[model samples]
Target: MRSLFQTYVHGSISAVLGPFRRYLPAVVLLGLLATALEGIGIGLVIPLLDVVVSGGSDAQGFLPGLLVSFGETVPRETRGLLIGGAILALLSVKNIVVYANGLLQAWIYGQAGHRLRTALARKLTAMDASDLLSEPPSRMLNIISNESWRSADAVAAVMGIMVNATAALILLAFLMAMSWQLTLVVLLGIAAIQFAHERMSQHFAGLSKIITDQNRGLAGRMLHLVAAWRLIRLFGREDFEEDRFAQASDSVRLAALDLQKRQMAVAPITEIAHATLFMAVIFFAWSLGITFGTAAAFIILLYRLQPQVRQIQAGLAALRGWTGSLDEVQWLMTAAPAEPVTSGHLPAPALTRGLAFEQVSFHYAGAAADRPALHDATFEVPAGTSLAIIGRSGSGKSTMAHLLCRLLEPTSGQILVDGTPLSEIDRVDWLAHMAVASQELELFDGSVTDNIRYGAPEADETRVLEAARQADADEFIRSLPQGYDTGVGDRGLSLSAGQRQRIALARALVREPRLLIMDEATNAMDLLSERAALRILEHRRGKGTTLVISHHLSSITRCDRFIRLDRGRIVESGTTMDFNEEQLARMLRTTGT
Candidate 1:
């Protein structure tokens, strides 16, 4: 919904000319010169037509008169060869320029495609989390992978309409100069044919939008199928997924067929209409007793003019078919708006005193107005200490963590570090001091060392091994065939749930962050492993700040204090001895389940 549409729609010719703008004047000049050369080549043919029609009488036409007065008193005997040679020369130059223009246009559009892809990628990375999440991931992927390229070609189609229109106009002017009477009749008929096609163009554009939407949906289905491949087999529902994919694909094919049928209808109908007009001009010339030389020249010009008109009409229809692509590229390139969230320029202060969320409240974009995911959520984790947040599923625990991580900004209130609004701190500087290991692991498809060193790419092997040892993963990792260099496979699927979580924890530890966040980080581990992981967390007690978000009481046994959330509200806050183990267990039994 957010886009550069207003700016792009006003310009028909961008790969909707964003990066190609600087070369516009040169490109336009070359295009115009090529078109002019083509027109001149066309005019040179007029004299040849006159020679054939009159069997060597003095040619009498505006163009033939030019050669007659072509900067010389020409001998009549050599006029035909002279005009013939001129025609060849003009055509050769015109074709050469046309070829070069084709190369330039191709490069311009290629650059546009490259720019569009890179720009969309940059925008996707740069957008605020909420703005990025506003649209479906599959749809975004569809635009970036497929639609951007199509949009570039769509821009070329739009340019085709422009250049073809110009050619038609120039040829029209030449027709009028030859004989306005005949030109008038021809113009009206051509106008009527194109007028009828105007409605077809609108329909084509409508179908284009539908196909674009359908492709986005299909992309979602494909991505889901790939992502859920194991799940589908485990559930024994491969047939169901196949049928679902088939239906979506069939729908896309039918829509495209309908569009192609409508598009193919343009050519024959225009040709038939113009063919009738072509003959009508011929018969009318006989009736008017126009001079033979002039009529031949007129017919020749009209013949050349016909294809240009056809190109304009056809390009118009095809351009309409690509309207969706242009719109999508425009959206992807500028979808984040001017400034979705306010950010500040100040450097992040060291976490000396504490980090506090004061009366923080946030809801998703389309959630209920009255009910927020986290409301009036006030809490603090002092420096050199750990705090535990216990909450049931959907109790806004992860939302709180996301806010803390600056993934999402609060709808109101402020998260301050050392009493400075966290929003005012440089985000990159803040992130460098923080790391998170959560229930949802994000292990990349790479070696164990690679995943551990992901954010800290320059981290050496000693740091990676030490981090893995801290997370209790070094032993199992060394047992694998490639040890630290073993490929994790897609999302680390080759590893067990516990193994992946340990790797994720190692990733967090490898950074040695100032504030470490562990959100259900030990859930996948066994009894011994979970206790060991909890013991490992205990080591950060006084050297750094730590926040543990968990439903299990054992996971936060070493925390300095605790906060409990029922739904979005912080229902309780206290030190460790405030609640008995039995009472804490009873309270958290249903938290994550």
Candidate 2:
């Protein structure tokens, strides 16, 4: 019991509830006031028993004797009425304080939940893009959105334990004053019962872990349903998915049912124990030749003390049940990448003179050192010029593009902006002046205008329309059911892949960034649309530099200069005129570009 209390109260709950710790003093004061009022009411019970049951003659013991002496100071005729009214008044005040304390605890619970969710979001944003990508999206979302609430409930359980223990201890003091010998026996018996009950709490901790794991699996399955429903339908896996989901759900239901069974059993078992203790107290009183009024008052106090003791046991069980989730919450808040993302204090990068890759190379974690994803390759793109990268799938074309965009860093070499290393620039400040449209397009659930404006929030309607026209998206967008106001479904799946590509391009162009990168951005567009998009690229020359990665021969031929990668190494570089259509086709065949 002592170990569990110390681990949760002083350990698990401490960091989880740190933000709300300062408010505990006020909670303690309100709890103390409520307990004091309850103790006072329990003290008055003996005087009431004397007036109503013993005809004001049978009062005994220290508390009853004190009340008896006070009763003597009052007129005997009205004493009974005064004592009963005072009891009701003290109870009413105690209930009021208890209500306020409940509200305070609720506020703490809400704030704790809110802060945890927001902090998780901030932590994810602060992480390196590669580190964030390594996390399972479904499990991360479940922890932030669902498990956080369960953890916050643990904080409420801790507060409940504290308040209930305070009331229980103060009521025990009342019992001790009335009859120390009986109080000793009662305390010892209750201690044994709690000791046995601690074993049940140990079981709850295990059950809580089962429930947490099962719920995480269930959440992952549900997310798969939302994200891949189309694929499920296309593959005709409806029945299979249903069976898998049912199994996951049943695991959660069974584990949760077992946990609830133990928790609900707590109150009833404590009730039976208290009833037995009640009978034992009466037998002890009779053996000692105790009066009816004094014994009656003691029983009344013990009955009132029953719920406080019951709450203490139940609260501890609940804390054990939720502390499993609380541990997860704490882990999420403190978990960090093996190495922090390298951030520099330099100002945003400037692409004034040119950009250079000085023997840049990269490989993903855990891959063979010799089989690097991108081998040592060097290139340069001067300001106000365009560079094209052409390679077949798995040639590390995308890796090189990501490096230039600062989404991933090269393993051994440096990428320089003008004369500065890319890592030295402020990431966020530099990204504001850059725009990228890639094959993995992400369109939010909103209108075409909203998606386009996402690239430049301050873009006016004229600029939005111009960018759309440049990407050859304006005609199709205007033909939609609601024109610019049409809502795209999740991930913009409601639109064709080609339509989404153009919208993504429009989004990139709306920003008028100093640097633009397009990786397989036109693969989904028809031949005419692809050519028109390239024409738009040609029109914007000299304003800034453009980097294009495509398997299309036309896209390669249109650029000012091009680099060809094969097996993660740059194999060739030259101007567009260096290769005729036949030579480009022969080169593409030999290099698998």
Candidate 3:
């Protein structure tokens, strides 16, 4: 009981005072005035009812008892006018107070929602790339959109209940003074009903947790399936996808239905207990010989108290789910980034020298020992040179690129640029000098110019158009109905694979970085387009550093040097023409291009 009291008080204080800190003094003053008027309204009802039932003039019985209790005496006629006028004044004041509270609550709710969303968005934007990839977009959206709103609603509901509960308790105290025995009976009945409700609340929390987990899973799956619709269609696996989605959706529905059943049972059980108590209170009141006015007020107090009791229980149950979700969100927010931490700026580009990797080794966490991805790899590329990593599908080519870019740090040994450690460099400033185009293309829903300008937002029109021309994307983009202003659909679904790749390449080219990394960048392009892109890359061989990860021998031939990896170890490294007959045959068999 003490724990619950503390939680209730803390929640109320946080909601009413903390969120509205600047307006606390004014809100409190208004609330106090409102609560006082509400008490007066409740007090006035007793005299008004008394006059109707007792055949009194000007509600003669109204002010006398209260005035006498306060050690005052007055004539009946004067008392009647004073009490009547007091009741009217309280009613008017109560309405105004209610209006003020509504205004204050609205303002507080708006500010609280804005603050929470801003904090959430800020946290999300600062999170590392690995963290962003591990969680689905819809789950993040659910937390930001639905869960935050739920928290706001819960806070508002609980605060309103607490305020109203205070008022109810004060009115109950007045009724108790009129007849202690009747008050005891009513209180006992309410306590018993509340005990039952507490039991219901405990049971409901278990169900609520199950329902929440299932709902999140369903949302995540639906978002994934929708995003992968094209792959599903190309593979002719619509039925399989539908069944997978149906299974997830059905689990969510069943869990929700079960929780609803449990919740629905609570109302009837509470109502039965409350009804039995109300009857017992009436029986006891009559036996104790309470007056008509006191009886009327006591019954009215029960009528008000019953709903409040149920609400307190239901709100507690609802809050359990909310708290559980908040804890999950906090866990996500506090999770560590996937990559290793480094404190300083990234090393300067090799420029006039070379980049070197000495005894590099890395294996993904939790992978089987026998299936380690990369082990003891050693390689180097000279200044103004392009290196193409060539190997079979399971080879460590892409892993090397990730290591070079510091997306993932080596498990052992060092990677150096111009003899400076890669770990010593700052992430943002280092990444600014590099452009990476991975196999998967991400085209945001925006204009062609916007997408091209993504790499260098401040790049002028001449720079953007030059990049597009170099990427061989200028002709296609200009052919669009709106040219550079055309909107790309979600995830670039509106564009063909070749078109999307060209646009992405254009974005990277616009940056004119010190190092350019391409992983299967030409896989989507036709033979002619791939040759055209290679011609463009060759033109800039001495201008900047370039690293290509490809299985295609033709692409590797375009680079100044070729490096081959076998089980993560660099087995061969030389100019393309120096490749042994065996290496050339292996490459031809692997890629068949």
Candidate 4:
């Protein structure tokens, strides 16, 4: 429990002070000034009560001593009015300062939130591709959108704790000056209640961890349901999914209830402790022959003190609740020490010569050591030449593509681009010269033109139309109600599978890359449409390099060269013309296509 509190408090401070360190001193100063003003206002209550009791008699105690020294020539009536005016003035100044402090804190909070979110995003972008692939998308989404915001809320809670704690301390100082004996008794009683509350509240941190896990689980399940809605309905598993979701939600509900119960107990326990202390203090003062007016003033001060103490306790509880989120944000921001994708200082040159893989071998992390994904695979594609890699599933076709794209580094051998080591070229520049379209299509909720222009945003309208025509999507796009302006629903659900693929193809083509990669990009299209797509590739045959990863036999016949992979090894390599009808049939049969 002590560790939990320390973690939360440290995280909250690091998040707030680390991002907004420059303005923190100013914010602290404002808080102190506001707290001082509040203390002065509370202190004036005793003098007002004294004036009322003695019918505007001369001021008493330390205040009177100061006022008499400061205003000997001032009249008594004027002095009383001045004191009343000073109290009002002090309260009015405190209100203004409080409002200003709120504005500054808000500014700091907004700045810190923006900084943290931006830094998280940048860190994710800079992370290694392998690390990113190992993580679940739902977890990343939850941390970026949900946990990051909660971290910002934690900052606000910390600031509240500071403000309230300061106010309580200043008020306590005023109370002690008024009557030391009574103030000491009240302090002791409040301390005892706070200690008990802390003991009971220890469970909140664990409960919060449970709620965080449940929320992430629920979010993952919800995403699965939405993405696989058709399958769920086809299998008639609606009730099953509902039950799973309900179970997750119920866990969250129970955890929240337990935390709330512990938190809600603080108020009543503190109130009881305060009321009993007030009664005991009154009896003790009466026994000591304290005056009624003094007793009444002290009671008013104690009443004001209770709320500040409560605010302090509530702020502490809120901070504890946010500990889990802070931990998540910290995890998201920290990157593991792994091999990164881009680490070169030299700019990537144009692929004028060719790309070559020299005895390349790669094994995924945690994969069977003996069964590597790609083993001793060696190939070369000369510039302005096309190469088709045909293999059955689990034969390392996709792994080769990933290696070519620099998404995965080769474990044993080097990949050279134009005779330069691939790792020595800047990744961003290398990627800018290449484009890929895979079996998985990623289309945002936008218009046809927006999706096509995603890769080459500055492409002119003429270029976009040409790219669409090249992908055989222009006619279908024109048939829509708004043509290029028509909106595609989320994930392009409003479009057919072929339409989405064509749009993705168009996105790749619009970049006019030096190397174009198509990994089963036309599987959804019909035979005629697939033939038409291949015709477009035929036009770009000698103009630039192309890598076609497909099981379809017809898709590879036009390539300049072909390679057959089986069990992570290259089984054969030659031009399509070199293979006889029998050999081609056997290759197709071996690949099951």
Candidate 5:
């Protein structure tokens, strides 16, 4: 709702252009040269017209009374030649200078946009998981793809408009010096019309925000549809999906229509204002019997003034709309996590001993009092030993794993690595020492080798193959048409669910973390594939810490000890041998494979 011409808008414009401060002088000089040339062209038209109209024996040779009545003292022939040549040269220079200014402004704009996107992306990527999860991907995508570029473009447009408008006003002032009465009438009339246009700009600015938000929503909806196309088709929900997307698209369309209507309304008003002002000027000039040169210059000045008025208004409106979009983008980038968070490489633990969760309690962000996800859950696993957590659905096993990973900090309690509390450790380094493979795997569109190497970017091809072999993915990968170079379609759609899981495991394994967490990592695998995966896990068990969260009782039997969670509490804890026949049956029944 703020005026784009306010002080803050000016300050922001200054800040956005600050980086290009060094180039300002060059750009301004170029603009000045162009403006000067334009002024010269307008002022030259009068004398040129007079010369063409005047006729004598000297006119065929050149001209007569060219300087006599034209307020110059040069000879007729020389004066005519000078006036003609100056007009042509000024016109040519004006165009060339204008072109140069355009290129300079464009380069500055592109650089500013690039800097914003690169800086934001670097910050977002390096942020800890807690910080990264604060906002949705759709919002981030919108800021990076559109808003940043929009800000840069608005900065450039506003600069160009300001320079040109100032020049036009200066020219108008010069014309007013010649005839104040005519200038006053034209200026006041134009001012009234511009004020009306400004009133309508408020509506367009509001619509701009809605349009941006809706377009972002539309993109999110389309992405969801594409992601779940298989399920939608199976359920015959094509029409349902289309309707939902249409609703979002329709919202965007309506907002655009509102802006378009306002813009259209502006066009006619501006045209009418220009026509009336011109007619009034001509009427006054004809009555006074103005000289040929004076009338010609006045008309040229009028032509120049109209465009400047229209552009200044349009540029002001766009600047407001762009600022609103920029605010949304800034909000998204600065969104806080559900809690305070920090990021960087964590300090290495002096002892490198095992991990411990001391009376840890965590509740979901928004949940009923009776429905805690993890409550008074105390547990510990020795370093380098594999621990399995087994529980039925809704038993908070995954929540426990998430807490361990620091994706969600415990509401009240402490998790320690060795002797140091996790909160004290630097986030990035702590996460680096751990790796996880969950039920859902996210794979990008890239070669198999590229995907595997993601876990350890510096890993060699040999290391990549070794990790794939460990996850039992190397064979299938090689059997594919391109082997390790085979492309994994978006989200690994080209691979089966089981294959995707294996590849995900390979990605994690390649990191060779001190602690590896697997939350239902083999859920999509067949019995044989599960067996192969367990062997791969066991093969590296003694070398590093492995924690598996699963519903499969058989899987935990291989673990040295198992913990069971119920209603956010660790209801039972003991070795597999400690389970009585009844207790064992109860566990199996609850899992109910």
Candidate 6:
């Protein structure tokens, strides 16, 4: 079980409040005003009952005395009516404040959720590629979409508890004014109930963790099922997949049910405890020879007080149940990598001398230390030169590209651009001068023009068309029903593989980058289209530096230089013309291509 203080002071709640801290003052003020108004309405009940029971003959309590003093100026027959009207007005004002407070809370809830989602997205963008790949996509998706909302809701629950606690204290003060002894007894009884309920907090927290784990598994399984539907059908494994999903779903259901059962039990236990306390107070009042009017008003106030206290208890339990989600959100925001990516303040210089890798070595986290991805390898591509990197699938070709892009920093040694260490240059300025089109193409759900001009949104239609023509994509794009306006489905699923690749190429080219990297960028195109794209690259040979990674021999035949990688080591490097037909055939055979 967690204490109320610990639950509210948890770091996750603070992180959730960071973005909306400015609006918190307004939220607190409205909550306080609403609570004060409610106390005033509850206090008015005393005078209303007194007016009814004694018919304006006597005024006993503080509120009753005040009403009596105010009524002296009015006629005796209308004193009760005047008190009743005052009660109605006070209740009306309290209701209005309550409504306004609800609106403010709703706004906070929505804005908090939005901020959390946006913050998580920005966090992902700032994270290293290796850090992101450490977790499954489904897990990240669940946190962004589902757990973010739960975390926001927990903050709202905390606010509700604060408001209820304030109202309960005000009512307690009123009860004490009426009779100190009765208020003390009632307070003692309520404290005992709260102490007993505290034991359930740990249980709720445990159940919440189990539910969170089950939800992550379920989400992962659903994504797998959707992505592998064709494989499942081909292998006749529909029943197997169904059973796996059912197990995940059932685990979530049972955990949620257990949590709900425990949560629902709290309300009943609190209600019974309060009911017994009410009867005891009634008997004590009788023994003390208390008046019926005084006792009735106190019991009415006590009855109202019970729910407010119960609400405080329930809110505490809710916060405990959400502890797991809060912890996840906090971890996502604060976790750092062993080798954090550092940004420099200096702007990157132009690549007049070109890029160089000086004995660079990189080992992915959790990989065997002895077998690095790229080991003690050094290379250079001069300005306006063309270089081809050819190797087998796992020969560290993509890893080299990633390092050059600064997506993954080298574990040892240095990468330099024009004699300056790459780490000393501003990442934004460096990346702005380079563009890459890899094997995987990512196109959003928009028109063809939108996808082509994605990186250069300010590019005019003329520039977009020129880039598309350079990538051999304009012909097919014009044949579509809406030409450049034709919609590309999610991830460009509406277009063929070749069309999608060409569009990606066009997107990269539209940036007019000084350095361009193509990693099997034209594998999906036909031989003729491939040749046409390569022609564009050849024409840019002396205008911009190009690094091509491919297994297709024809794609790199015209390169100024070549490097062959094998088992994370560069096995050969020389001018492209140095590789004769026999050597090229042997290299292809060794790589099994």
Tens digit of per-residue lDDT, candidate 6, span 1-593: 66657665668778877777787677667666765666666655555565555655254456446644555555667766876677678778877877887887788888877887888888877766877756787778777777788888887887787678777887888788767778888999998988888875558887888888888899899888976777899999999999999999999999999999999988888889899999999998888766565677678889888989988889888888877777778777775642434666678777778888899998877889888889988999998888889888777888899888888888998988889898888888888888898766589999999999996889999999999998999999999999999999988878887899899999999989888999888888877679877887788788888899877777777778888888788988888798876776677678764
Worst 10 residues of 3 by lDDT: 55-64
Which pairs of residues collide in model 3?
344-425, 344-426, 345-425, 345-426, 346-425, 346-426
Worst 10 contiguous positions by lDDT, candidate 4: 63-72
Model 6 spans with C-alpha error above 4 angstroms: 1-6, 19-29, 47-51, 54-75, 225-240, 335-352, 365-368, 390-395, 556-560, 564-567, 571-593
Clashing pairs in 6: none
Sorted by TM-score (best first), the order is: 1, 6, 4, 2, 5, 3
Candidates 3 and 4: which is better by lDDT? 4
- TM-score for each prediction? 0.90, 0.87, 0.84, 0.87, 0.85, 0.89
TM-score of 2: 0.87
lDDT of 3 by residue, 147-210 (tens): 6666566556655665556555665665565567766777777777777767666655456557
CA RMSD, predictions in order: 3.3, 3.7, 4.5, 3.5, 4.9, 3.2
Clashing residue pairs found in predicted model 2: none
| Candidate 3 positional error at 546, Å | 1.3
Residues 365-433 of candidate 4 have per-residue lDDT tens digits of: 767889888999888999888888888888899888888788888889988889999888887788888
Per-residue lDDT tens digits for candidate 5, residues 100-175, read 9889988988886776667667656644444444346676677777677776777777677756676666767656
For model 6, what is the C-alpha lDDT against the true structure? 0.80
Q: What is the lDDT of residue 507 in candidate 4?
A: 92
Scored by lDDT, model 1 comes in at 0.78
lDDT of each: 0.78, 0.81, 0.70, 0.78, 0.73, 0.80
Query: Which residue runs of candidate 3 sit more than 4 Å off their true CA positions?
Result: 1-33, 51-64, 67-85, 133-138, 168-187, 337-341, 345-350, 359-377, 390-412, 562-575, 580-582, 588-593
